[model samples]
Target: MKQSQSHDGSNAQIGAPIPSWKVLIADSQPDQHDAVGRCLASLRHDGRGVECLSAFSAREATALFGQHPDIAVVLMDVGLDGPAAVQRLIEHMDKATATWAGPGLRPRVVLCTRDPDQWPERAAFEATAIDGYVVTAPMATDRLYGAVLSGIRLHASMIAQDSSQKGMARVMVSTAGIFELRSSHHFYFNLLLQINSLFNIVQDSLLFVVGDSAPKDDVARIRAASGRFSALRNQTIAAIEDPRIVSAVREVFQNGRTVQTNEHFAFAIKTRYEVMAVAFIDGALGLSAMERQMIEIFRTKATTAFSNMMLIDELNASQKAAVFALARVAEYKKNLIQGHHKRIERLVSETAREMLQRSFHPEELDEDLVAKVGVASVLADIGMMVVPDQVMHSTRVLDGDSVELIRQHTIVGWEILRDAATMLRGRSILAIAAEVALSHHERMDGSGYPYRLVGDAIPISGRIVSVVDVFDALISDREHREAWTVDAALSWVTEESGRLFDPLVVKAFRTVVARIREAEPDWLATEIASPALAGKITTAKRDLRRMIDRITHLLN
Candidate 1:
């Protein structure tokens, strides 16, 4: 077998002109290879000429493929050694190409034969992955040129498609990861940028969303934008100067369907609750059929992601409402002052924010944890609901038995929240609430509560709520005692730093108190709930019934 080389009878040189396309010609007859090479020596496609690689046997052809991995087309003789040798060469090429170029990126193969009756076109294609068959009895140069060019074009098209598919997969994974991090704006903006990158377009794009509670006359506002449209984010559609884009967006919103026009493409994404939003791709009029199909796939995936985010938001809201209703019921049963839990919630939230600002417990602190610990703090005394009314409301000093019974509320509250958390498949807020209920009363010195946990052994959530809960109780008037002065309560908390509270928590608590004193000195005197807190109270009655029904279902 002869060694493979460029048609010039020498190895390719460093300064040799690079051809736009490479074609391999494999046959046992050296004259056949030379004749085919001579016929196509001056031919060019897309203004660039082709380079031919000569291989004298099946083994030489396989070796040529290894040397030139970028070869776009292969011209093989069906009877090189036998049908078996040709088949073996094809299989080897397939495995080798697929390893580097991927399964969808194999080179195009065109078979040549002297006897057409032995290898018909239909049988040639079915038996092997050949792109074309040429009858070489007369060696028609025109037929040979046409077949080789067609194979090169087909290979180029395959490479384009494979690249598009890979780009789409990467975009999907990146968008999903951003969504998981809970930044909806970042996720949407990243999707738009990726769409442009995938299609090789530099056009402006805009994503508009209309809330479910929006009025009929309300216009969709831009949530995310790219290119020139980026400056107009959070603006209504009317803000865009392009009449063509405005019309397309309106048409999509009105019809609740995708709109394709001569100048733009607008897609209305629908979630379970409503027609979620519209994605406007400006200057997308000339997208090919494949590009359009890829956009549709992206739209479908975006819809699923939108629906999932909405579901999670709804679930979190429902959990918070249930917790508030349950806390209110316990407070009412114990005849505690109104707005007491609300104050505790605010105090806990403030302290948590301060802790995060100070970088305390950096690994465990985040915005989500701050929000959850505050809401869960309201459930710290949920065990009070199980205490007897007489023992809870007694004006007289409590006896030893009464004191022990009162302490049991901590254990009882933990059990209730722990069971509810289990029933909810371990919802994070409930798990934190269970920890607060169980350990909030325990002192840092191992002296307090049912479990007597010491220092950091107690969960951070419990430690945070313990300090804030005590501060609120001391400053608020109770049935058995008058309210202490703010200064006295603050001094007591500062003095009990490590003995009765987590030192880190107490540190944050001091900062929180100082801020409150500076910003809202009369905050403690105002028993009236803020508008937002008042709304929560107004819904408590309605949510109480729902909470009971849910708990009943969980119990069953």
Candidate 2:
């Protein structure tokens, strides 16, 4: 006969403890109080059961954590009345697991928020460190149980990975306390000095950006340490992107978002020539499991760093856009070409999206970046504005002086964009645009100007525009040149692929050109040169197509 365990008048089977599993419940509501206990009482794995712990408030939750280091899973309410805490005690516990705890600790967390979408908690949940989330609603017990089981399995995998990297020597400490490790601090500083021996490790490079105010002192320590460890900090800063990776690191610290990598982000970083690492630093440092109390502390520091990194991408994009805009204005004025810039923008955008879709094995062309590529294309000819009208329109070959002034536009574009760095605070895509605007004239063989940056040194945007810009220019009737037929221009670009263009970009251009032709047979010859004006027509066509597709799919 089977035994039955009683909870809230419901009976659940109870057997021996589940191997490699322990569960904790951190909630205040009586229903959750009853339902969770009943659910836990029923849990079984391979016919074995679970070791369960329960807590009602944030404080009790902490006590439960103290006693049960092997707690594999936690069901935590997002809010707990612990001195008006900005973050739930569950978050605090989760942070502790990831950043400070050793093996036999580091519980996987499941957040149960009443109104998970409100204010800081919502942002915290999105950015915070938790294995999974379940909104408190009817039938939420099922969701809670599933999330817990999944988190436990994943956490076990992470434990395995950390176990593999057990031999690496590193220090795990609080944000401020990190500097206290004299040898590591000294080593970090020495690395910085070797990279740049200027201004004795500038503190400006080491500034921290915090997205939340609750960890005010945490932010202060990271900031305050700059003055004391100026050398170490400056070196760290020099090695980091501006706005600082520290800001993102801090947000992650306070919130503790599960750190996962996507191919798009991975590719973007590589395309931009950056090296990024996500690590379980605490586990690597040989910290004791009881020392898991420092999880929150590590998270705060990591969040600041991560935030700063994201901010850098944003800033870089903004600066690029401003520069491109300025260049476009100059180019438009130079030839009095009203819509030439606009046409280029459309061509570039269409080509890039198509190219990204085709060449990237994982087509992760973000919709946002696709729009940005169009904007960059529109501004690519802006540098041509710095050239005099006579030279711009002249069919005659240019003199040395005229060529020299024209070559200065890339630098000019960069200069005009430097002041509007704030505009770039959140968009990294624009920076790629700026690179395209400034370097579109560059040849694959290092024959381009402003910076004779060859091969991969030239931004992908620059490479992309190289094919699009040239094709547009060849097929458009500019002041000094007769327009070539679409077929002629296409053949020219396709033939020049590796010699004058990125081969992948050239191939993408062909596909886009084909798409445009299929979409509109006479599109190339229609002569809608002004992109802003043509946009309305294009939008209408897109809308109609979407409607037709929806109707067709529904019928199918």
Candidate 3:
């Protein structure tokens, strides 16, 4: 006997064939098969009824179990064959189901017998992986129905668990892929997008960074969003129009737990660096238990990934700070003014930004590259630390040997930075700094020192820093020459555009100088006394003092 079922229940079309769970009855007696079939004919679980399959002997039962691996329940008669035959059939079924159906889909087995003394419940359960037992003499219809129903329910639960595990595995793989993205904004956005996709939910989701560390505002702020909440990205909690959503997010953050209702679901994820909240709008209301479990697993993985990303960010910031401090030490040893490196940093940053805006070296220019070159500009003359103090501070004209000794600073600086780069595993900022240290003295016409890298052979970072470093030096007072007027310095740079500088770089430098003049008409006249320059000078002094104190403490 077969029974059919439909997902739509009574609303399903009449007479249309629907899927059903398969229940196999293995018994030598035809009457016993009929009786068991009649007992389960009207039974249903999870909107699906059972279909009965019969096998008359142990051999036939093994074959049937193999053929219908999807069968959810098996009613085995212990007396159909001898006890040894029954044991062999059970073994065959176990092996077949494990091989053909996999972990969660193996059918439940209910052993039936007329002799309860021979096959005691404890012994039957201890011997085989049977789910239930029934006595055929009494043949209670309710007991048979209950056994079949329980088997079907257990099978459904296992399948759901198996599916959830697979879903989570895929989510983990995708999470790893997204972590490869460099930008935090893109990382969070794709994370929310993946969560929505995994559950086949509407893309209405929002991820918020909670606690006082959030940028722009200290309170919770939306860092990533999709669907109708897209415009709310980077906005504070007050920007969300839905009061319920706001409340739920606050609850999660305050309690550090998950909150779920019919209309929304929100959870808090705490990392070593910050607290975060992920909320799904309306889409999470109707998810199954398996889906909820999967979401929990995804939440844990995302927290770990987010925490690691934060740690990387912190490490990068620390590296940049260390690089700047090293450059400052060289500056102090050279006895340069407190703000000289800071001014070079500003000029290089402005020139690089201008070059980027003009689309110079489009293949190589980006915001990250611009920032790196700017920070690296301070290290251009780090090799000056190797110059003899007498030659470095000479008031009179230097002879050829003195000049040669000073020029060796470039190579020395390059080696210092190159070794540092190696120590850092070739980090890009250090690599760029090494390039600047090596080639800042190289002129466009191959007349410069070190390698004399001519024209485009010079790394763009080196080229930009070369022009700015020379301009800064030319306009600053030195023991050998009085400070040149801004006009004189500009005239020299413009005249040497192609001969000594990359013409494109000189053009961008000119724009940068123009912007500087427009912003501070008395910039050179005020020199280090200008308000903006003074602020930077004070900060440099403080940082230098802190570095000196740290070194002194270490020595002590």
Candidate 4:
């Protein structure tokens, strides 16, 4: 990794070794855009070159976004306004590019406009998502270049994360989604903050949920709401402080139904023991029916998540830590695939639930089975814990001997769960885990290793786990390969249906995947690196074996 130096001690310049970034220029005015492009045509940042893409109008920009998602930065004119303007187009373009259907890139946008007066103000830009901006001033060469370089750096960070910020924003929200609240005011305030951030509700909004009440001695209400309703909190008596709030509360309580508008949304959730929990969101724009529906669906999920979180809180601290430790046990020591177990667990759960809803497999895959599959799948690779780091993290290809040794992990993991008659004596989840660990690698066509059980002989848990386990592995980056897109990975699954997987299970998986992509568009966009290194290492090991065998024959 040493840099070469010239006779005079100056570092030698390499022959175009730096990667090129795709930067698109979107402007209606030919002269302005061309001038900006011409100036920055030869610009380089962090030794990386720039590849320019031109789009004269909003339509062309949209088309280019689909064609080249790898475009790292965009400079668009804002005069088009609304759908046609660069400002609005950036918002729509984020949604369009946030899927694996294309090159899986997230481009940073910089607003460029000829009208100086029309430039976005600091307050507006700070609150919204305009990355950079430039007015049509004469001496803007340095200014524009600075903006573009700054944006390119930001885009680089986004690429490194694989998924864009927009896609991951919902993960936090989803984790907080609980079905019931224990009138925990701390949790309620936090939940309110989540809703506000997710939907971009303003400070002026009156956000509150009234339902079950906690003990007054420990509960801190009214004035301690952190300015959510500062005026209401400051009121001495705290009775009928706001007539608007009173009317809304009364309406929700009386009707016992949900209400919605551009400015408000109300969902009266019935908590455990038939206690009605009235949740209201105010001063948020309704945007569209689809968006509103998305919010409602997330609300339901959040409620469930909340209930689960509460249940977890009730568990002994040691038990909770142990469960989390089990999930993390699959992480590799070196530069290997991280979060593989968790990814498989989530996908398995989703796919199982999706399959259960459909009549394709009928009797076998139901809600109870799906729950078992999810819980069991978490430890699907527990056998890997016993596999040596040499095999798991080997940069070079592993030979048949090594592979065979590593494959024993399935048996090893299952044996630990099943053979441990004392420790795991009556744990249902462990029994399910044992089944998955042993048979998850078994193929539909009897080509899989170990026992090589074929078709339905493979447990449904094993079948579903096999599909998602391979899928997460395929999409995750390895030392040998770049990550494949979600589209590519799923297509590969479809291609392998029946031969390597159950046809009905694959169908169910596809339905689940489609629903997930629909529910969270960003889910479609997240993909990992390829395992090309793994392939190379395997080839190397086999060649070594062949050479050694030939040498032994010569010695004989």
* lDDT (C-alpha, whole model) for all candidates: 0.77, 0.54, 0.76, 0.63
- Comparing 2 and 3 on TM-score, the stronger one: 3
Let me know the TM-score candidate 1 reaches against the reference structure: 0.63
Ranked by TM-score, the better of candidates 1 and 3 is 1
TM-score per prediction, in order, is 0.63, 0.38, 0.60, 0.40
**lDDT of each residue in 1-556, candidate 4, tens digit only:** 1111111212123221334777788876667656776667666765566777778777788788778767788887776543236555666666776655233345878877666566555644764477887775673888888888888888876664443344345645544443343324445556655555665545443334342233223121232233355455423223546655556755765687666654556655443422344555555453343345556666666666555544433332223234334555454332343355566667888888877777657666755566557767877777788777778778798999889988898998889867632453343566778888899999999999669998988888999999988876777666667778888999999999999999888888888888778888776443432355345555545654575555445334
Clashes of each: 0, 42, 0, 26
List residue ranges in candidate 4 displaced over 4 A. 1-321, 334-338, 419-427, 524-556
**C-alpha lDDT of candidate 3 relative to the true structure:** 0.76
Collision pairs in model 1: none
Candidate closest to the true structure, highest lDDT = 1
Q: Model 2 scores what on Cα lDDT?
A: 0.54
Model 3 lDDT, residue 185, Cα: 66
How would you encode candidate 2's per-residue C-alpha lDDT over 1-556 as one tens digit per residue? 1112322212122212225366777777756766766666655543335656667777777777767666777777766563234255545665666566664347777767767555344565566566677786664777777886687677666665574344111113123333332222242333233212211123322332232222222231222123334544313323444332444444444454522121100000011222222221110122223222233334344344434544444444444444344543454355333455666677788877786666542343555566566765565555565667677657778889888887886766544443333354544444555566688889788888778878777777788788887887788775456789999999999888777787878887788888888998876662423435334544544654575555445334
Q: What lDDT does candidate 3 reach at residue 196?
A: 73
Cα-based RMSD of candidate 3:
9.3
Model 3 residue runs over 4 Å out of place are: 1-162, 181-186, 200-202, 210-218, 231-235, 238-241, 274-285, 327-371, 386-399, 467-543, 547-556
Q: How far is candidate 4 from the true structure (C-alpha RMSD, Å)?
A: 29.3
TM-score of candidate 4 on Cα atoms, chains taken together: 0.40
